[model samples]
Target: MADITHRRVRTNGIWMHIAEKGDGPLALLIHGFPEIWSTWKHQIHRLAEHGYRVVAPDMRGYGDSDCPADPASYTILHLVGDLVGLIDALGQDQAYVVGHDWGAEVAWHLCLLRPDKVKALVNLSVPYRPRSPQSKPVEYMAEKFGDGFYITQFQEPGRAEKSFAKYDCLTVLKKFLLVNGPDLLAAPRGIEIIDFLETPDSWPSWTTEEELQYKAEKFRSSGFTGALNYYRAMDRNWELLGPWQGAKITVPTKLITGDKDVGFQSFGTKSYIESEFLKGLVPGLQVLVIDGHHFIQQERAELVSAEILSFFGKRSGN
Candidate 1:
């Protein structure tokens, strides 16, 4: 692994800490919620070795980045703008953008908002879901799957945050990383990991002691407020993106989802995403299914990097 240098870049009224390595065509990598720039550790060195400048940032509230108090500050548009500003700060006109989870949401918005700033896009775990004019996020979820219990929990301001704080964020993190289909099915009323965090001893064997500690310690540095804020900005993001609801993204786009990941199956949006989101909204888009869960980038780093490199290389004619 190559040494990663850390630098602070000012964006969206906060100083974001970015880890960068190598030098070739610039590649901007953004990490999702509960993860910092370190999430791209494996890819940074690998991409750098493959002759690309890899830059990964701890967005807004993660790692060494500044955490703002207001939840509205964490809106998707704001997050995406911070990334665009980071690119300007680095003096790059545009770069190949790759992101996972919430980072994927930002990447999608960036491509939609400013196509010139993005050479190509690689999104993992989360697919592009265009907002409908008549549908509220909660209502949309409920219409499809009766009740969106997860989004409902997040709608509560401090409930999930308090639960994560109580468990020291380890219990929820462990369950998120390791829970399988059988465990999910065995639970009677849908397994809410936040509810289970109240008792850490009941945490399953999916994550080892060391892995749990690593995540817990990272959250300890800033607590769960910053991460939770991302969820809190749903309404604000919808408001900001009202003008872009029906916009079609023209950039080269690649969507990667983990096969076993519950996100695709959540409210049964997998087929909807393929038929509606990608094919319907974005033009010239490709989808890739990998074997894993939500944290596919971390679980399958080399494969993810290869896919990203291949997509960007082909687009760049390299």
Candidate 2:
């Protein structure tokens, strides 16, 4: 076991609980929606052993962090600013950043908006989707692919949050962690697994019962509202990025996704992601495909950690 310490720092008017280990070459890890600092448990010890300072924070609304009632506070710009504030609070000028899901979206924006604060970036699952200058989100999706069911569902005001809040929120979150196809045939309840069923390749190796219980307990610690606020900020984030629409990120960047990640096939974004998003990157950029689902860090922690360590090692040396 690594020497781990839990601490809190004030950022963006809220206190964020962060877990830190090791002491050289700072590597800041950010977890996505429905997850807390514990999500990076596997990577924290391993990365620290490899001579990197690992800092994982309960991003604003989850875990022991302060949960702001205002939905607007969860916007991408605010999230990015929160991370910048975190770095300042830590007294570091810049650090290599790694994020998954919503965290990845914020990491990408952080690199673009505060390039001086990010030495390198590793984003899992979600790829960089550049906003167009005069394109309405609906029109943009229609031009690239039709419907965009996920975004549409998320943009449906309070529908998703309310539904999940009413239903078994923990179960819904567990279904997403399934890297393979839905176990619908075995599950007692016949609820259809959405993202996991659609993109089986993105699923990571199955987590142990202990691990699953740990994550489930965390979700129960705080109701779904804080996590769901991330979804509620879609339009707000869109408006926030209006000024930086079409701006390319010029930094050391790497995008990692599961081969069966539903996000790639999501609304025909695979082609657009490869052709447009990846191509728009101005500096060092690379895409990696791993055998896992959206939560690759939790499922395939060794592989994810190795890839990130290699990327940061080479970049830091240069």
Candidate 3:
């Protein structure tokens, strides 16, 4: 951890802050909402020790990275462009990419839009869903799960931010991070999501008070608007990425998710992952379902790091 260095690199019209260590091949780690580069601290140390450079960036809106004010700026193109520019800025033509949650969504598009830039991929939580040509993402989410659905509720610019502001940053983080199941995510019709989500009396053994405070402090300083803007740009992404509809992610890939992860449990994702559907889209794709929740990398750090090492090491022939 002491060898890890932090700096900002200019890429895709913005400066991105990253935490990095080691010096072999690049292993780009992209984080999801409400988190920072430190989320991969465990992986960084382990992967570096195993002979690969691991760079985890706070994607676009979170941590010390630049936060563009326009929701339109957070589209899939912008997100993928950021990573493409990042790979170039890092002096690498290709990388072994790993992402979690929103980061996984971005990684999927990165692989789709520019497979040349990704040597291989190991994404967590979110699986690749082929674009639906018939409906925009936000509208589709509304039709399928109604407005109270978290993603649907996140559509309105300031709605979720206001709901989140009701609690202190620490409590707000706790509400999201400590959630144990998918069923607890959606609010009951008119209820605000942050208000609906319960805060646990005790913290999980995998995470510490220090880590939570660090994440809370970053969110408090940056505010949630930029991060929530990713959700706000869902429809825009659907519009802008129309050309990529039904595109296959040809890169060798692995999808590792917790059995209890909200993304895996909700929206018929389990069936999607289990069926031939996912394999049809990601050819040669491997899926690993483990015990834990959405933040599986952090919760099961050793297993996650080992899986990553195994997958990428094989790709690199190390």
**Which candidate achieves the best TM-score against the true structure?**
3
| Better by lDDT, candidate 3 or 1 | 3
Off by over 4 Å in 1: 139-148, 182-193, 197-212, 314-318
Query: lDDT of each model, Cα atoms only?
Result: 0.76, 0.73, 0.89
Give one digit per residue, the lDDT tens place, for model 3 in 1-318. Answer: 588999999999999999999889999999997788988989998888888888999889888999988999999999999999999999999999999989999999999999999998999988999888888878877887776788888888888888888899999989888889768367788998888888999989889989999999999889999999999998888888888777899999999999988877776788898788888899999999999899988999999999999998832333
What lDDT tens digits, residue by residue, belong to model 1 across residues 1-318? 358998898876679888899888889998886777777878788788788889999888787888886788888878888988988988899989998988998898999898999989988988787876776675554455432255555656776676566564666666555544412211224444465432345544333576557657777887778877887787667777899878998889999888877777653546866684468688878988878777777778779888988887732233
TM-scores, one per candidate: 0.87, 0.84, 0.97
The TM-score obtained by model 2 is 0.84
Task: Give lDDT for model 3.
Answer: 0.89
- Please say which candidate is ahead in lDDT: 1 or 2: 1
Rank the candidate models, highest lDDT first. 3, 1, 2
lDDT of 2 by residue, 77-152 (tens): 7788789999999889998999998889889889889999998899898888776556556445434543334444
What is the full ranking by TM-score, best candidate first?
3, 1, 2
